[model samples]
Target: MTATAPVTPDMLTIPRKDTGGGLPNLVGMTRDAMRDALIAAGTPEKQAKMRVGQIWQWIYHWGVRDFEQMTNLAKDYRAMLAETFVVAVPEVVTRQVSEDGTRKYLVRIAGGHEVEIVYIPETDRGTLCVSSQVGCTLTCSFCHTGTQKLVRNLTAAEIIGQVMVARDDLGEWPEPGTRTEADRTRLLSNIVLMGMGEPLYNFESVRDAMKIAMDPHGIQLSRRRITLSTSGVVPEIARTAEEIGCQLAISFHATTDEVRDKLVPINKRWPLADLLDALRSYPKVSNSERITFEYVMLDGVNDSDEDAHRLVKLIDGIPAKINLIPFNEWPGAPYKRSSNNRIRKFADIVHNAGYSSPVRRPRGEDIMAACGQLKSETERGRKSKAQIAAETGT
Candidate 1:
């Protein structure tokens, strides 16, 4: 009898690279799909159910990049899993630590593209700002990442991996084999999908990653603690509340459509009226969990006292708070940060109007990890190469 070739598993999966088109298939299978995969792989129904639990625990709780690390499983079973599935994380190309104790990482996704993840350490809380896409689709004139054209939506693995990587850096893993509420809470206190891309534009992947993030058997982050920021992707706002059920933040940088159109180009598409209409009807949003409107103050742009009044009127009757972010300038950004006096005046107007408006101090600016300052060095290199080609007429 001829000897059968050894049934070795192929386990060389890595982050998907951008291809200027649709995103790569980087294991976006849902939890149900994973269960089906386990059952189909000859694991008995009961064992398959048990195995899915085991795998999910290892993947999320431990951040294991390989199936072999699941030492509790039979060796052959681990090989079977390796042959079929992959648990991958984006490659860390560059990492920076700011003097203020902030951390920023440039993660390489597939297709030679990259995105940024930032960790801001505060006195009482640590927040990890995670990305949803490779670059961004919205060309918000003020945002550094927005200047780069959208490549593709990041896979669920890529999105969740960011939190895992941050936890690894923070050394906050649960004691090896088990997890408790106290242990998990001590790991990463909060997550905000406020990084390189527009979360609403990449809704499906963002939703999947969030489901995994909130899964009781996995990351177990509370819905109240998670916030999804969008630049008024109006059509999807209600669905985000109904499906994802996380806190909502609108990137409402300007009070009027005329100014908003120039700053956030997507405003021409959604406009303020439609965005507010959706917000008014958003399900489960209440005064206790008010929507957050993020206003980036640009000097002599949207920081006038009159502008703040228009903002208060615009968001009238909506239970919301405002976060006035002083623009954090990147090298080639066209706008300047608002003056301290202007920012304070803007906040005062909104605050006196009986709504909570906080002026956000720019964080991680030294590391290029602050608000609107998250383009990767790899993307900057690519732009330089293109400029050289144009200059040399090659």
Candidate 2:
């Protein structure tokens, strides 16, 4: 769907039932939605709003799951809430930690479908890469996750659950009445919607989950620290700026439409020129200083100096930072990583053009948790030896 195209009421409705066995997950719902849900669950109308605030803090701010831990609420009221609702996140099927300290989680959501969430811990900060869909719709040639077919859009619970899951693994949640806020540093500080699926394709769930992440009383991540990356879904660009108001990143892998159409197939729909126009206007709409243009460097495809110059021209007016990602190769992938010299030359061209061009260091390569390799390898390992051989024609 184009970024600007009106999402029909039907399109906004995710097909899965939010309430399970008569108990709804309160993790994803907005404040207003939660308040209404409480009233619907036989809560007194006068107390619903107050109850939502309490429950919201207990679940999000304090990371409390059991209603018994909601000590501020009365015993009977806590029992009533426990009987009527659930606070759930995706279950971690397996977690792999790379040699460089990047942690990749294979998380199972509703319906047994799984997605990947990666946490990269740095000295000063940490970034979590979260998925919006179970698999993916677009087949970006360089992305490993694109090989899998789209399963379904993740619910807001599943989406925000990624953050919670990573926090659980990292032990980053604040403990009550302990050290001051100044004594702590968040291990999962930044979030990027750059995993498994193209986020804009699953817009509403992503937006709502991000809102939960940004809420001051919950995850409390600043809007600046969250980035929503798209493969040039033009119509939704403006809406993303107006509604989501987070940082934006484009999967601008190629300089020209001909090359881009092959690298990012979504370019065939929105194309480079049209995408640039939307990007140029993004800063004013989102009130963000700069947009990130992610250029994956592949050998002999679109990494030429000419392509670099063309890229500079393409994004001339917009405030942008160019991320030069050396292609992270996966099994059966068609491309090779650009040579170090070639990447430096390309970076030099963009740097000379006055854009901050940083070559993204490959992280979590040992565990297949770098830029694109996030399909559950454990699932692939489940195939019989004969089945694997047959698929490979070996």
Candidate 1 has its poorest 10 consecutive residues by lDDT at: 1-10
TM-score of each: 0.89, 0.90
Candidates in order have lDDT scores of: 0.80, 0.83
| Candidate 1 lDDT by residue in tens digits, 1-394 | 1111111221122344332234222234567877887787777887877888888888777666567888989999998777766666677766677766677888887777788898877755788999998778888889988777777888887888788778767766665566355543353678999998999988988998888888887778889889999998988998998889999999999988999999988999999999899999989678998999999999888889999999999999899999989899876677888889888888898999999998888877877889898876576577776763542234
Candidate number of the best TM-score: 2
lDDT of 2 at 375: 78
* Cα distance off (Å), candidate 2, residue 381: 7.0
**Can you write out model 2's per-residue Cα lDDT over 57-149, one digit (the tens) per residue?**
888877888889899899998888888888888777776767677777787777667788988877778999999987678978888888766
Q: What is the Cα-based lDDT of residue 181 in candidate 1?
A: 58
Error of 1 at 259 (Å): 0.2
The residue pairs that clash in candidate 1, if any, are: 16-110, 17-110, 17-111, 18-110, 18-111
Q: In model 1, which regions exceed 4 Å deviation?
A: 1-28, 178-187, 384-394
- The best candidate by lDDT is 2
